[model samples]
Target: MPVLRQITTCTEPSTVVIERRVRTRDRSVDYRLEVCRRHRWLASNWTGRRSAEGSGGRCGTVMDYRPYAQIVQSHADLWLRPLAANGPEDHDGDLAAALRAGFEFLTAHREPTGVAIALEHAARITEAIAAGALPLVEGQAQVLAALSAAETLDAGARGA
Candidate 1:
């Protein structure tokens, strides 16, 4: 069995630290989960506090992770379905909104890995648009505008 411990501080209401230790055949391993309030980002570490750098920075009020995760997942699903089906005309607004959310997330987090993934996805989406693989529908100029904004932001972030 593993032991779990939690630590909280009133001064930093947005942060919660959870520690768990499990005994293995050879030794014991410790894991830590840190929840940040404002960004609602989850940071997990196998070793100690030094490894929590992945969780953005220290700011904002903490919120529940489940709801945030669900919202993000739902947005991602909604945005991806149209691309997967090559049905952008059916989901122009949705794709635009999703791209905006994704850009915000990347800007806030600034994680190298996540930024890399976003850049890749953006490139692919742009290529698809340019190739006419994804067509726009009525009143979907917002989609083009959103894509352009996201691409510009990404380029600036990358110092390109």
Candidate 2:
């Protein structure tokens, strides 16, 4: 194993490796593991510069270790759905529900990035509603009140 180490762990658990180098007793055994999709292979075929004289230990130099990181990213890509290009119907309760779901999802999923995403979604939905999306009725005061509350919450959060 080489004393220098590099570790990369992605949000999607995948690849991992440990490396080290040693010099002693006129000989040393350097060990390393390269893993990908349950595949394991030895890289012991390396032992020095292609045309160096005297003696030198292999595994002390850096090499292309990207294959390991690529494995981890492969798993992360599977976890998220691609946003649709056409998006939801421009004028339907279904569109409201979908927009509401996105706002809800953004709030419930508290990432370090914060809940700013939810506020943006909320604003977009409100804008759509104001543009004669779902016709407002005199008796829709209840709905408007609820929307006001949600807006106030989002505004307070932004100020905080």
Each model's backbone clash number: 2, 5
Candidate 1 has a TM-score of 0.22
Candidate that would win on TM-score: 2
What is the Å distance of residue 157 in model 1 from its true position?
2.4
- Candidate 2, clashing residue pairs? 1-20, 1-21, 2-19, 2-20, 2-21
The CA lDDT of each predicted structure is 0.37, 0.32
Question: Which lDDT tens digits does candidate 2 get at residues 94-120?
Answer: 434444454555556566222334333
Best-performing candidate as measured by lDDT: 1
Whole-structure CA lDDT of model 1: 0.37
TM-score of each: 0.22, 0.24
